[model samples]
Target: MKHGRALTITITLLITVLFAVSAGCTGPVQQPSASPAVTAPAADGSSLVFTDQEFAFELRRTIGASYAGEADIGECLATASRIQEGDFESWYTEWNRTADAFRAAGDGSLAAGHRVSAMEAYYRAATYYRTAEFFLHGNPADPRIVETWSKSRDAFRDAIALDVVPYEIVAIPYENTTLPGYFYTVDDSGISRPLLIVQTGFDGCQEELHPYAMEGIRRGYNVLTFEGPGQGEVIRVQHIPFRADWENVIAPVVDYAAGRPDVDEDRIALWGISLGGYLAPRGAAYEPRITALVADGGTYDVGQNLLQNLQEGGGAPANLTEDDLQEWLQTDPAEFNDAILGAMAHDTGTRWLNENGMFVFSAASPAEFWAKWMEFSLAGIAEEIRCPTLVCAGAADHFDPDGVQAQALYDHLTCERDLMVFSDDYGAGSHCQLGAFAQSFAAKFDWLDDRMGMSG
Candidate 1:
């Protein structure tokens, strides 16, 4: 769900146009492929295609102790089996049902004075609820969207209340509103420690950042995971849209972190995941206070990658310039929305893409959404980053294969930088190394440890 590239309306329109042309000449039209053409092999040495790709990747994400337990796994797999591929309703129903079961179990445990059991169950329930709402992007007003997310948030709050480590709910002041966050430390040792400010990319919420926070805490780091503009509660509750000026978002977070006695002001690190690959670097470019930065599965230029995918998938003209595309994106909003809706009628991917993009970016139409995302590139600003940076990528990443964005980012950085590529042989070649989080975490945190000089 943490997507690095934009889902452009141009591609959807092109697909719709192409389908019409082909149908006119060749008789009845064929259905789009159920799965994406490019399939990545799973960590278990099996290739996952189409709808299975996302489900399998998510399963990998929750496999470790940072997210799920054995009971959670059983429930998730059972629910996954019951859901139909690319069917949003089925996906939501099954996961929500499992989450409800876990919620009940957690409540029972709490009533029986079993705090540990309650914590574990509540955490898993929160994760399940988050997953349930992942694909429900068609309607912002859908009561289920807010209801499921609220359940996830409340369950996470319950789990955090019982945490052995110190956990505090924080409200980081943004422009006019406060960003919601959770600050986690390994202990209340009253020692100033290296701090990690964690941000997730498109489609990820702060509740899903627990694994990264847990990893940092185990490595003697204080972690602050927050939902920024266009993410999680900020978007759902505050109605804030995504912005390209991530520095505005991060500067306030850094200000809040610096004020905390438990955080070492001199050793603060900023980490961004998925589309955050572009965001973290963009922030580090403007916010010089950050001592170190990490882009998990680095993304250099989201617009450029989107154009490439459009060319490949829709056979759009390859010679199109950004300016030219922008001009086309300035089409009448009504016309653009009509095209998007027409495309969405036939293509499931197009429907989800348009719905998700419109909701997150707060665009009135497809043209506005496409135009807004054009600024999400790190083309000219990557060189402005002045901190020790780590750029991570997976060799077979469908999102950024062969470290395309990571390598570009490393090449652009004028400061000390490291590029770590996860290989397919290690079963870590998917985006963000989904199936190999432990290995990815070890590599990422080890680099941070060396840079921050954390004593073992």
Candidate 2:
């Protein structure tokens, strides 16, 4: 019912390009007995295949909490600083060398100094993503936002797959080495890809998978990225509305993924961005079979977030006119009445931006705000995440919760959960900005690789 990242879209997806963020792997996976291929498709639209390097890298990058990544942190940091400080050329010049440095360091252990250099590379790319998001534009209703996010997602994926962690600058053989990894060990004939449960942010949907989802598939994972009830296409086209019990809603999604025989039951993981950060955790809390959980730039308390945004907007009411409500009331009171009232409540910022049925984001009414807020709080269920977890946030993120929720969630994890927060201080983006995203993603995958013992 309040403003959110959707507002910051500055009106499109092509805001910027390039972005980044990672960790370690422990052992090699023994080949499984031959079977049949699952319904999964690799990036090439064929069965999954993996070389050992690709396998190690793919798992390493999956979790999003890595302290290790593929790029040079110091170099990445410098490049990003140049771009943000208004020097694209300098950033590019430095980035080229840093990129080469990462290739040279490929699959090797990273010394702290080398790691810092790698971070610089990732940082620069991440900054680029933010630039594309904020500066480039078309319309929120157009493909720009989608295109920009896709780029941002890929940038982060790049950072993770490069050579090292951008923030910590530690060199380790981890997910950071994936290079947009190819994850299958055997041909796709008999193997099912890992089950990746992807969910969108506040206004995002399946198409949002472009960058990150694409990376996952390249690494041999069968990804199922979806729009929650009130998000992007789900709400706009499908007309599904938001609900309080977000986790409950996702339960069926998990079941749907699990029902697929090709899906590795032991490898099912929930990956969510922004709002999905909270939603994914909630789902894991309610359902324990979730093998892994990645909540990126998550919102911890909906009530707190909603209230903050509203207060920022001067507590003004929606854009809906009284007359519109009267006309809809002529229809049945049960369905049409509420629908009309929602239509009349048009001025809602991020909840839904529709002037007719729903704007894009908004509480049907303020009266329903607190009720929904209390339902999404992480206090009760965050700890229920029993699988290894990766919780990420942008320290200076304008698009998400600024790491408050992620910090809280990370602190409470009983499993091997890692929390990483990024900002200019750490050389990252604002919210889901490409700048911060690259580092954020690298950090997450690095952490995941470590937990999975993928570090060589």
Using all chains and alpha carbons, the TM-scores for the candidates as numbered come to 0.86, 0.49
Best by TM-score: 1
Q: In candidate 2, what residue range of length 10 has the lowest lDDT sum?
A: 17-26
lDDT for each residue of candidate 2 in 1-456, tens digit (9 for 90 to 100): 232222222212211110111100011111121011111111210002222221212122221222223233344344343342222233334434444444344323234445544443453344333333432221335454455445444444454554321111111121222001112122345456566667765544343343565445544566565556665434444445566577666766666666666667777777777667777877887887787877775556644443334334543234422222222222223432244234323312211222211223334432233233335567666667788776665444433423445555666666666554444443343444233345544556555545433333
Poorest 10 consecutive residues of model 1 by lDDT?
19-28
Candidate 1, residues 236-285, lDDT tens digits: the string is 99999999999898899999999988889999998898878878888999
Report the CA-based lDDT of candidate 1 relative to the real structure.
Answer: 0.73
